[model samples]
Target: MRYRLSIEDMEPNHWVVWVLDLPACFSSAQTPVDAVALAPGRISAYYSWLSSHDSSLPVITESIEVEIVETFHSFASTQDQEYLVNAFFEDDRRPPNYWDVELALRLLQWTRQDLLKVVQSATQEQLSRPMVCEVRGSIAGIIKHIAGAENWYFDQLDLALDRAQLPDDPLDMLKAVRTNTRAQLVKLMGNERITKNCDELWSARKVIRRTLWHERDHTQHIAHLLAHL
Candidate 1:
């Protein structure tokens, strides 16, 4: 029942909080305490709405894992980067030289949750609204592009997942693709034979960098679109 939460400083006197485990559950407040205070109500409303639409929705418990990334002050410090680097290298149980893959998985989880916050909040009307600038596609179309690209990246690892027709709900489609990508990543990272067989283009280093970049790029795009909405 526990869920993860990610909080980031958005601007002076404003903080954005996201329930990482729950799609579309985000709130902003002028203070970090207020931001944290808003989470329960937002979560309750999300579950209430979900239950009204589908009786099978599970109940959420009070437990939470919170990760606060405050970027307004400064970028990640050396200590923070070192912590991530150490965590990536110290887990020796994983296949040798798979640190990049593991790091990518961690980052993907963060970016996907950020992306979901926007997708969940968008109305059908908003999703269909035409883009005004040079950036191609409507909000929903861009989301589909993000999911589609992840699927394509998995294919580069020689792990072919059966492509299903995209669902009308952007969140649903994203969840499906994210699940498949994570599975493929785990399989590839754990298997030395598979890793060795992969082409240089799909090397863990390249794959991790490209995947993170793609996710972050589109996440920013979604944020921009939401700002316009």
Candidate 2:
């Protein structure tokens, strides 16, 4: 039977060719198309040659599941500034590996809160007001941009954004971000080589570390912009 595989469905790390059959299976690398003759007898000869080879195949494991969710804010000043900063400070713990969905989720949540704090502190006006900012567009724009950018990361894990797929309400967005991100993390945990969607943007490390660095990078960007203002 023929099998089809989507880029997102491809296993992380190592080149993997999955068999699109029931129960979900995968295969290792294949030989060059030009290597063998198209003779009927060539097939058995190839298998015999393969059996004679003194080598062992690598072990393949099942995929991990990760869940992702979005967060929304509906606060004036204190809620936006103090609460978010405090929450982020509390959730700053990280797991040794991004393979752990629980740790990744916790770090993601902390980074989200950290971003909100930067937005609250960086904005010139407490309430909604037009002001020229360089990196950060606006307070609301910052929130939306963060949500959208994070969704890109979720897409790498083959999960839909909760805010986009399921609901749009603030509380619901937060819940969805949490759920989907976690599921995605779980999906990739067992992968021996975690494939990163944007290797140019980050190294081949776990997405959790890249995420923290991304948030920190943006925070510094906003800080530089705000400093000039």
Model number with the top lDDT: 1
* Global lDDT scores for all candidate models: 0.59, 0.38
| Candidate 1 residue spans exceeding 4 A from truth | 1-99, 132-135, 164-168, 190-200
| Model 1 lDDT-worst window of ten | 83-92
What tens-digit string does per-residue lDDT give for candidate 1 at 120-189? Answer: 7888888878877736568877887877777666665666456666565666777888887777776655
Instruction: Report the lDDT tens digits of candidate 2 across residue range 163-198.
Output: 447454433454566566656666554444433332
Candidate 2: stretches off by over 4 Å:
1-102, 119-128, 131-136, 162-175, 192-206, 222-229
Error of 1 at 55 (Å): 34
**TM-score of predicted structure 1:** 0.50
TM-scores of the candidates are: 0.50, 0.40
Error of 1 at 129 (Å): 1.2
